[model samples]
Target chain A: MLTVLVDGVASGMLLFVLACGLSVTLGLMNFVNLAHGAFGMAGGYLCVVLLNQHGVPFIPAVAAAALFAAALGFVLERTLYRQLYGRDHLDQVLFSIGLVFVMSAVVDWLMGARQQLITLPAWLQGRWDFGFMTVGVYRAFLIAVCGAIVLALHLGLVRTRFGARLRAAVDDAVVARGLGIPVTRIFGVTFALGSGLAGLGGALGVEVLGLDPTFPLKFMVYFLIVVAVGGANTIVGPFLAALLLGVVDVAGKYYVPQVGAFVIYTAMVVLLLVKPHGLLARGAAR
Target chain B: MSAALRFALQALFWGGWAGAYFALPEYLPLLAQIAIIALFVLSLDLLVGYAGFVTLGHAAFFGLGAYAAGILAQQGWGEPISGLLFGAAVAALVGLLTAPLVLRGGDLTGLMVTLGIAMMLFEAANRMAWLTGGADGLQGVEMWEIFGVWRFDLFGRTAFVYSLTVLFLLYLLARLIVSSPFGLALRGIKGNRRRMEALGTPVRARLVAVYTLSAAYAGIAGALLAQTTQFVSLDVLDFHRSADALLMLVLGGMGSLYGAMLGAIVFMVAHHALSELTPQFWQFWIGIALIALAIAGRGGMLGLAGRLLARWGGR
Candidate 1:
């Protein structure tokens, strides 16, 4: 039971890392970016190519993957995402879905449709026994890395000057702009940062989540669930939501093998019906 | 805009399909598929174009209908028309139950809830492999001849007529509904929910009614596909089908019944041609088309045609 909990927590942490970026974008910008997973996919592929084919070191490759996704995010935001900001939700959904399709097909073209495997370093392999409970080293590493990211993200959002501006902009874009905040620049940077975090999560999650051309589409719901259930416009909401989802999903899979993901999807719909704004609805916007 | 022109277009549309019977006999199967897809898209149009609910999980109803009809046929009820009704009835019942859940929130919430429900159904179908046939799809689904007269031949001649006839009947029903006072109320609600409510319209009731009706339409379309093809697969419930249906509706033009059919025909033909050459790469083109559609603005092919026609008429 403890082992399942640990595994669930670790996976949940990875989910938090993966879905936090989406929360910010959805909460702050109110942009329904279904294509967010494409960046994560790109990060996964980058790590695969760097570590296996190029023989880059593990830590550097992961860092490079995050940077690469950030840069890609920055470029796409300026060129493509900026135009759709004022549009309605339907347009945003369609455009982002289109982006997802294009990216998935491109990845499929470049990398064969087969799933790519990453070779974790020797230290990151195996498991460590802690008294009555045992945990995999890679999963522990994931927990540590993702935990640090969550802490850093929390502090950065609450304490930093940029975070203040971002919060203000999220609160009211027009008022923030009037207050001389570079709302557009903040959005671009925040978009890149959120995307960068997704990339980091992607690189780290490759072992657990699997990497493929369909990465974006397959995991799109997970990210959306995290953001939707966590409630937008807040960090703690998504973190807790992701953890709960991770636990529920992991436990559901382990116990009720027959039901599979039906449990999670059903829970999401019920939860949405009960709390349409999300579990943590403080300052939540449409 | 005139009645004569409208009647002529209608005649031409049916005349074209009737013409295809003799003209392109070998391509009847493809035409039948186009008709089925058009019906599906038309259902989506009722929800999206008319009711203003942007959903990504319309395939929930479509797949439900397919499985209901397919399973019924497999379990010794090989009758076609009843199979279609059973499919639609099952889908409509589910839709009625879920309408309240869907109507709870705004667009994003609706999208998520719909998607979640569809994913749940997909998982259920996948896990219940004993009944659904799992990944390999439900095989040995033997469909009976329509009305005990026209047997389904290899050439698909009977299938085309049956599907086309269903499409025409449904098209007329959809037309009547959209032109009715209830449809006008739906359009009003879509335009301004608050105002509609203030104007003494039962907004929720109307929405539920239309949503249920649309689900039934989708079920009929799915039943048609199952009966005509004599097989049902998990792909019927796939996310791609929902996305493709949305794309087809948008490509044809939203809120326009004729546009729905036109878009289906064009999209299916292009998909057939493109996928024939490179199966995977065709999706890239479809993506590009969606992006283009988003950037260019709404109304799709019919929208563009309307603009051009207006320009010519103004001169």
Candidate 2:
């Protein structure tokens, strides 16, 4: 049971890294961008190619993949996403889904439809035997990496000047604009940063989540679940939700493999029924 | 816009649709699929266009209907029309159960709820190997002749005619329902829910009714697909199914009945042509089209065609 919990926490942290970008874009920016996973897939492939083809170090490759994805996201935000801000939620959903399909097809053609693998360093790949519970070394590394990302995100959003401006923009774009904040530029930067985190998450998650051309389609609902259950706009809400969900999902598979993936979705629906606005509404937003 | 003009337009539209029977003999199977997909899109049009509800899991009902039909056939109840109706009834029941959750939230919440419900169903069907046949799909579904006279043929001639007839009947039923006062109330609710509520509408009940009805329509479409193919797969309930249906609705135009038909036809042709040209990468073009459609000033292909037609008329 303790082992399951440990594994779940590691899984949850990875999900948080992948889904936080969506949380901010959906909750803060009010944009239903389902293509968020596409960036994650991009980062995963980027890391794999860097590791396999170029013999780059694993840790630096992950960082490089994140930077590359962030650059790509910045270009998209400036060129394409700006046009979609004024549209309704329905349009946004369809638009992002379309973007996902396009990215999936393009990647499938470019990289072949097979799953991509990254060679982890020997130390990071070993299993650590700790008496009653033997945990995967990779999971421990994931938990650490993702925990640092979450901490940095929490502090950056709570304490920094840029985070304040972004929060103001999320609270009320028009009012924030009146207060002399560059709302569009802030939105663009935040969007790129979110995409970068998704890339980093993807690079870290090749072992746990698996890297594939259809990663977006396969994991789109999981990302959405984090956003929906977490209530968007806040890093902590999704962080907690992801942890809870990750535990539930991992435990479900560990204990009762019969019900399979249904348990997490059932839990999500019940949670949504109780709190339509989400677990943390205004406090996290503020 | 008037009753007479509406009648004439409907006649021309459906008449042309039926006229294709003798015109496109080589593509009967494809035409049958188009018929089923058009019905599916029509159901979505009611939920999305008339009721202003955005769903990402409409394929749940579609899969339910398909499975229901396939199971019935496997159990030796292979009658076509009855199988379709049974599938629809099951779907309506599921819709009734799930619509309350949908009504509680706004558009985004509703999307999440519907999607969650669909995913739950997908997982259920996937895990229940004994009942659903698991990844191998629900097979051994043996179908029978239509009305004991016209038998299903190797070339899909019977399938095309049967599906088209079903489509026409369902379209007529849908037209009557949409033209009723209840349909007007749905439109009013879509336009402004608060205003409709202020005027003494049982808003939740009406939404549930329409949602259930739409599910039934989708279910029948799924049943049709199952009967025509004699199999049911997990893909029937996939998010891709729902997304493609939505794409068809958007491409055709929303809020209009004929838009569903137009969207289905255009989407089918586009998918077929693009896949033929570059099978592995066709979705790229579809994605580009979706982005373009969303960024466009208005709605879909029908919307653009409407503007051009109006411009021509004014001239």
Candidate 3:
């Protein structure tokens, strides 16, 4: 039970890393960026290419991948996403769907539609034997890294003046513009930060879930479900929802094999039925 | 008389063009398939374009129809018309059952719910291999002749005529609906539900009705697909089917029934042509085309054509 819980939490942290970015982008921009998953996949493939093909170090490769994802996000925000602002949801959905196809095709063309394996470095190779349970050092690293990121994000949003201005702008963009905040720049920065986090999560997740071209399509639905159940505007909502979904998924797979595939979706349906506004209504509530 | 003659001439010109291509033996089957796809797109456009609902899982209705027809046909109900009705009935039933839950949610929430439902159906179909043929799909579906007069030929000749006739009839029905008071109500609902509610319109009920109606259309399209192809596959339920329907709707121009037909023709032709040229990287070209269309031709091919025509006339 403890093992399952630990594993669930670790998986949940990974989901949170992806869902949080989606939640913020959807809430603040109201832009349904289906290409977000593609960005993450791109990061994963880049990490693999750098490490396996170019013989780059693991840490530097991951960093480079994240930077590349961030830069792409910045460019997408300026070029495509800006035009989509205030458009109807249907337009956004169609445009994003088109973007998804474009990105997936590019990735498939480059990667040859085959699953690539990510090899962790020697320093992160060993396992920690807990007498009854053996856990990989890399899993521990993921949990620690994700925890640190959450902490950093919390501090960045609460303790910094930039965070304060961002919060103000999120509350009322027009009002913030009236008060002289650089709303456009803040939007770009926030998008880049979100994309970077997705890249980092993608890099880490490839080790756990292997890298595949269609990986984004398989996970995009779940990520959207997490974001929907967690509530869009609140940061912590995604964290809670991801953890809940992850645990349910792990447990369902173990206990009930027939209905296991539906566990997360069932949870989402139930949550939406109960709380239409989602679990968290405010960002600070986390 | 002159106005009527002009309208008839115009119709004949376009109809003859479609009929000429459809008369070719090799192209007839492809034309039938495109007609079914066009109908599917038109149904989706009614919801997404006119009603402002962004459903990513419209294939639920399409797949439901296909399975309904296949299952019924396998059970000795060999009549094609009855089979089509059965498919549409199943689709309408499912749509009605889920309408309440779907209508209550916001755009993104509704999208997720529909997607979840579709995925659930897909998983269920895969798991219940006995009933659904376990992913290999239900085959050997034989459609009975129309009133025992015309037999379904092996070369798809009968299927082409049957599908085209149904397509034309449905197109007329869709045109009637679009110009009817119900379509106006749907448009009003799309604009502002609160305002429609204030005006004493049963917004939720109207939405459910429209959704069910659209599902019926999708179901009929699916049934036509099975009837024409004489096989039913789980691919009908796949996400790609829904994505293709969405792309078709967007590429044609939403809210215009003719746009759906135009979009289907263009998309299928592009798909067929591109695949023939580069089998491995065909999807890459299609993807690039979609992005280019979305960016440059905001309103799609029909809209672009309209603009060019207007410009020429103005000049």
Candidate 4:
């Protein structure tokens, strides 16, 4: 029981990392980029190829994968995403979905339909056995890494100038532009950072979630759940939501193999009915 | 559309399809698939183009219709037309039951709810091996002769004509409904929800009505696919199915019934040709097409055709 809960916490942290970008983008910019998962898949593939084919170490490969995704994201932002900033939500959704299909197919051609796996370092590969309960060493490492990231992200967003600029740009682009905030550049950098974060999450999550060309379509619901059920644009909301969801989903699949993913989806529908904005969103009085 | 334009459109459509049937009998199966797809896209147009709802789980209704008809046919109630009607009713009932949840939220919430409903149903169909046939899908779905006369021959001629005729008739009904006052209200709501609400329009009720109507059409389309193909797979409820339908609608043009037809024909033909060459990589080309469509032409192929039609007609 303790192991299951601990495993859930680890999975939830990975989900938060993958989903935070989407929530912030959805809430702040009102842009529904469905292809967000495509970048994560790219990062996953990149990391796996690096580790498996090129014989690179794990941590360095993850860092490089994040950078590669961020660069790709920057280019896409300049050429494609900029054009879509003012389009309808429907157009954005459709356009991003198209990107997803294209990316999926591209990945399929590049890598066969087989799933990609990576080897963990010696220290992160074994289990840490306690007298009463045992947990995987990798799981403990993930919790520590993700916890530090969450703390850093929270502090950075609250204290840093770049974070303040990002928040301002998100809250009201026009007013922020009037205040000489370089809004467009801020948006570009922020979007790239978000993409990079998704990439990092993907690199880290390949073991837990499995890496495949269909990664985006398969795990899209989880990312969206974290964003929607947790409040969009808020840091802590998705964090807590991801933890709760990760626990519920893992436990549900374990206990009720018959129902599979149905229960989580039902919970989402009911939750949305009671609180349309999100579980943590302020009253929709505005 | 003007009466002259409308008449010309119908003549061109029927004439083109009928002529194509006689010319390329071998392509009947593909053309029939295209026609069913057109009906599906038309249903989406009623919601997205006219009613201002951008959904990601429109396949929920399509799958319901397919499963309903598939189950009916397997149980020996195999009359094709009645099966289609029953399937449509099932889809409409599902849509009616879920309409309130859809109506309660804005676009993001709407997207999530529809997606959630679809995923839940998908998982339900996947797990219930007793009813939905599990992952292998429902088998033994046989259909009776259409109106007790035209049997579905191996040549697929009856299937082609049946689907095209069904599509034509449904198009007429859709044209009538969209031109009606209720459709006018839907358009008004799409343009300005706040203003419509201020004008005392029953916004939510109208939305529910249109959504239900659209689901019925989608169910009929799904039923047509199952009846013509004699199979019902879980792929009917797939995310790709919904996404592909959305792509087809956009490729055609929104707010025009004929756009759905034109878009469906073009997209399906291209997809068929491309997938034949490189099944796995066709998405690369489609993605490029979508990107081009977004960057160069948001109105889509049909929208451009409409512009040409107006210019030529004026001349």
The candidate that achieves the highest DockQ relative to the unseen native structure: 2
Cα lDDT tens digits, model 2, B176-252, are: 98899989999999899999999999999999999999999999999999999898999999988899999899989
Docking class of 1: medium
lDDT of 1 by residue, A1-286 (tens): 8888888999899888888888878756888899999999988899999999999999999999999999999999999889899888788888888999998988888888998898899999999998898999998898899988889988998999988999999889999999999999998998999889899889998998899999999889899999988887678899998999999989998998889889889888988888888898964445
Candidate 4 residues B210-247, lDDT tens each?
A: 99999999999999999999988899998888888888
Question: lDDT of all the models against the reference?
Answer: 0.90, 0.88, 0.80, 0.88
How do these models rank on lDDT, best leading? 1, 2, 4, 3
lDDT of 4: 0.88
Please provide, for model 2 over A207-286, each residue's C-alpha lDDT reduced to its tens digit, 9 standing for 90 to 100. 88898978997788788888888887678999998999889989999999888889988998888888777788663422
What class would a CAPRI assessor give candidate 3's docking? acceptable
How large is the i-RMS for each model, in angstroms? Answer: 0.9, 1.1, 2.1, 1.4
For residues A1-286, could you state the per-residue lDDT of candidate 4 as single tens digits?
A: 8989998999999988887878767777788888889889888999999999999999999998888888888899898988888787787887788888899989999998899988999989988899889999998988998898889888888899988988888777899999999988987887888888889889999999888989998888888888888876568888998999889888987888788889888988988888888888886522
Better of 1 and 4 by lDDT: 1
Error of 4 at A99 (Å): 1.1
Per residue, candidate 3 scores C-alpha lDDT tens digits across B1-315 of: 257864885598458636756466787777778878988998898888788788878998999999899888877787999899999999999999988877775776677778777877777777777787857988768778877778888776777778777878888898799789889988998889789999999888888988999999999999989878878888998887887888888888877787887888788877776776644376666666656666664577778777876788688
Query: Which has the greatest TM-score?
Result: 1
The reply for model 1, stretches above 4 Å from the true place, is A283-286
TM-score for predicted model 4 compared with the true structure: 0.97
Output the lDDT of residue B4, model 3: 80
Estimated TM-score for each candidate: 0.98, 0.96, 0.94, 0.97
TM-score, model 2 to reference: 0.96
